[model samples]
Target: MSPFAMRRRHAFAAGLALPFARTAFAQGDYPSRPVTVVIGFTPAGLTDTMTRIIAGRMGRELGQNLVVENRPGAATSIASAHVAQARADGYTLLMGTASLAINPALQPSLPPRDPRQDLAPVGMAYESPFLLIVRADLPIRDLADFVAHARAHPGRIEMGSSGTGATNHLLIAMLAREAGIQLEHIPYRGAAAALTDLRGGRIAATWATPPDAMPLVGDGTARALAVSSRERMRTLPDVPAAPETLPGVHGTFWQGLFAPPGTPEPVLARLGAALDAATRDPEIVRRAEESGVVMRPGDGGALRAYLASETERWSTLIRAANIRAE
Candidate 1:
C-alpha cells in the first residue's frame, strides 16, 4: 500500500476508536470525586450502620470518600428511586437492603423503581440474622409458648415490623400460613419505631436485627423467641432457629452495594473490588461479628441471583397474605 493511503486508513481507525477509548479511561479513573452511598432508612438502623462501617473502609481504599446519605421514606422506595434516577456514573450508589427486593412485592401499586432493573448490585456488604423478639413480660417464654399464645389469641397478637411489606412483616405472614395462626401485623416507619413499641409493651412482637436488638434484649427489655436463620446465632446461643421451631420458616436481612443500572461494567468492577476489600477489613469484620453479621463478600452475580430468589420467596408469601405497603 502507498504511505499516504496507510496514513489515512490509520487516522480513520483512530477516529473510530476514540469514543470507546474515552469511556475506558473514564471508567478507570472512576470516583474522581466523592461517591455517595444512599440509604433508605434512618441512621443507626441495621442497614445504615453496616453501610457506614464499610463505606469508611471502602473510601480509604479507593482514595475517595464514600459519603453515605439517608433518604429514608416509602419503605426504601425513596432512596431506590433517587439512586435509580441518578447518573449511571459510579459516584452514586445505594446501600441496598433486602427491602429493595421485597418492596415491589409489598407495594405493587406504589410503582417502586424495581431495583433489579434500575440498579446494579456491586457486591454484598454483610448478611444479618433477625430475631423474633417479644416484650419481655409477654405471656411467652419460648417459641412453643409464643406459638401457643399466638394460636390462642389469633388476630389479637400484634406483630410489628419496620414497615408494611418489610422483611419482618412478610416473614410473619409466611409464619401465619405455615403455622395456621392469625397475627395482626403492625408496620412502623422503621424498625426502631417498631422495636420502641415492643419495648413499651404497646406491641406483642417484632423482628429486629441482632445489631439493633442485642442491647435491648441483653438489657432484659425484650425476649428473643427464635432467630430467622436455620442456625442459631453464636452470641445468642440460648435462642433456637425459627426453622427448627417451625419447619420452613426462615428469613434474613442482607446489605449490598448498588449503582444506577446503566453504569459501565468496568466501573461496577472497580466498585465491586473496593466493596470486596471493605468487607474483609479487619476492623469491619470484628464489628460485624460482634453484631451477628455474617460476612458473605458476594459479588454482583451472586447478589443478582440472591435478589431473584429472595424476590420470588417473598412475593409468594406477600401475594398469599394479600400484604401491601399501605
Candidate 2:
C-alpha cells in the first residue's frame, strides 16, 4: 500500500477507537455524583436492610453517596424494571434479589423478563436461608418427624408462605417434590403475616427467614425443624439442614448489585471492587452474620454465574409445578 493510503487507514482505525476511549475516560470518573441504588421491596426487609449496610460502605469506598430508593410492587418487578431501563451509566443501579430470577420465571409478563440480559451484575452482596418452622405445640420435634408427619397426612399439612410464587413458596414446592409429600400452601401478603398465623396456630408449618425465625424459636412461640440451606446456620447450629431430610432441596433468599445493561467494563470493575471491599469490611460481615445473613461477596462473574444457575433452577421448578404469579 502507498504511504498516504496507510496513513489514512491508521486514521480510520483511530477514529473507530475514539468512542471507546471516551467511554473509558468517563467511567474512570464514575459516580461523579451520588449513585442511586433501587430496591424492589419496602424498607426494613432483609433486602433493604442489607442494601443499606453494603451501600453505605460502598459509598465511602467510591467517594459518593449510594442512595437507596424503594419502589416495591409487582413482587419487585417495578424497581427492577426502573433500573434495567435506566441509562447504562454507573449512576443508576439495582439491589436485586432472588426475585430477579423468580419473577422472570414465574411471571413472564413482568418487565425485565430476562435479568441476565437487562442488567449487568456488579457483585453478590449476601445470602440467607429460610427456616422451616412448625407450630410450637406440634408433636414434630425434628425434621424427620416433620417429614414423616407431612408424608402421613399429605394434603392436610397447611404450609404458609409469604405469597404464591415467592421464594419461600418455591421452597415449599421444592420440599414437597423432593420429599414426595403434599402441602396445602397458604399464601399470605407477606412472611410476617404468615409467621403471625403460624404463631397463632392458624398454619401447621411455614418457612421463615433467620431474622424472623430466631425470635420465635428463642421464645418458644414456634419450633424450627430445619433450615433451607444445604448446611446448618452458624447461629442455629442445632437446626438440621433441610437437605438432610430431603436431599436436593436447598433454597436461599439472596441479593446482588447490578448496573444497567451495556455499562462500561471500567465502571463495572470500579463498582465491583467497592462492593467486594464493603462485603469484606469487618463490621459488615459481623452485622450480616448476626442477622443470619452470610456475606459471599464476589465479582461480576460470580454474580453472573449465580444468576444463570438460579434462573435455570427456579425456572425448572416453576414450570414443573405450574407456578403462576398472582
Candidate 3:
C-alpha cells in the first residue's frame, strides 16, 4: 500500500475511536453526575439519617455529590418501586433494610417486581438491635417478669410499633408467637410517637431502637426489658437479650444500599468499596455509635446473601404469625 493511503486509513481509525473512548471513559468514571440514594421512610428517621451520612461520605470518595431523597409511605414499597424501575445506571440506589425483604412476604398484593429481584445489593451501612421497653412506671423489672405479667394478662397487654408490618412490629409479633402469649398490637405513625405513648403509660411495651430508647431508659422515663439481639448490646450491657427469656426469639434492623438491577458490575463494585470504606471511617463510626447503630460492614456479595436470608426468615415468621399489610 502507498504510504499516503496508509496514513489516511490510520487517521480514519483514530477518528472512529474518539467517541468510543469517550463513552468508555464515562462508564469507567462510574458516577459522572450526582448519585441519588432513595429511602423508603420519612426524613429524620434512622434509615434516612444513616443514608444521608453514608451518601455524603460516598460522595467524597467518588468525587461526586451523593443526594439522598426521602420517599416515605406504603411501607417503603413506594420507594423500592421507584428505584426498581429507575435506569440501571449506578446513579440511582435504594437505602434498603430488613423491611425490603420482609415487605414482599407480608404484602403479597404489592406490585409485581420484587425488591430482591429488581435491585442489586451493594453493601450494608449499619445495623442496630431493637430494645424492648416499657413505661417507666410499669412494674415489670425484667424479661422474665414481663413474660409472667403478659402471661397473666394474655391479650390485655399492648405493644406499639411504627406500623403493622414494620420490622419492629414483626419482631414483637414473632416473640409473642414463640412465647405463646397474646398481646394487643398498636400501630403508630412512627417509633417516636410510639415512644411517647409508652412514656405516658398508654402501652405496656414496645420495641424501640437503642438510640431512641437509651436516653429515656437512662433518664428514668422508660424501662429497658431486653434487647432483640443474639448478644447484648454494648450500649446497654446490663440489659439481657429477649432470647434469654424466650430461648429462641431474635431479630434486628439492618440498613444497606442497593442499585437498580442491571447496574454495571464495575459501578456496583466501586459503590460497595466506597460503602465499606465509609463504614470504617472514624467519623462515620462515631456518629453511628452515637445513634446506637453498630457499624457492621459487608460487600456486595455478602450483603446480597444476608438480604436473601433475612427475607426468607421474615417470610416464615410473618406466615406463622398470620400478619399481612393493607
Highest-TM-score candidate:
2
Question: Would you list the rank order by TM-score, best first?
Answer: 2, 3, 1
CA lDDT scores, all candidates in order = 0.80, 0.87, 0.81
The sequence of per-residue lDDT tens digits that candidate 2 reaches over residues 1-326 is: 43323433454466456797546546576778999999998888778888999999999999999999999998888998888777666889999999988887888778787888778899999999999988888889988888799888879989999999988999999988887889998999888899898888899989889889878888999888899988898878988998887787898999999987766677889999999999999999999988999898899999999999999999999999888877
Candidate 2, pairs of clashing residues: none
RMSD, candidate 2, Å: 6.7
User: Which regions in candidate 3 have their CA more than 4 angstroms from the true location?
Assistant: 1-27
lDDT of 3 at 2: 32
Query: What lDDT does model 1 reach?
Result: 0.80
lDDT for 95 in candidate 3 is: 85
Q: Which residue pairs collide in model 1, if any? A: none
Q: After superposition, how far is residue 120 of candidate 2 from its true place, in Å?
A: 0.6
Evaluated at residue 323, the lDDT of candidate 1 is 78
279-323 per-residue lDDT for model 1 (tens digits): 988878888888889777989998998888888888888888877
Error of 2 at 30 (Å): 1.9
Superior candidate under TM-score, 2 versus 3: 2
Query: Once model 3 is optimally superposed onto the true structure by TM-score, how far is the C-alpha of residue 310 displaced, in angstroms?
Result: 1.0
TM-score of 2: 0.92
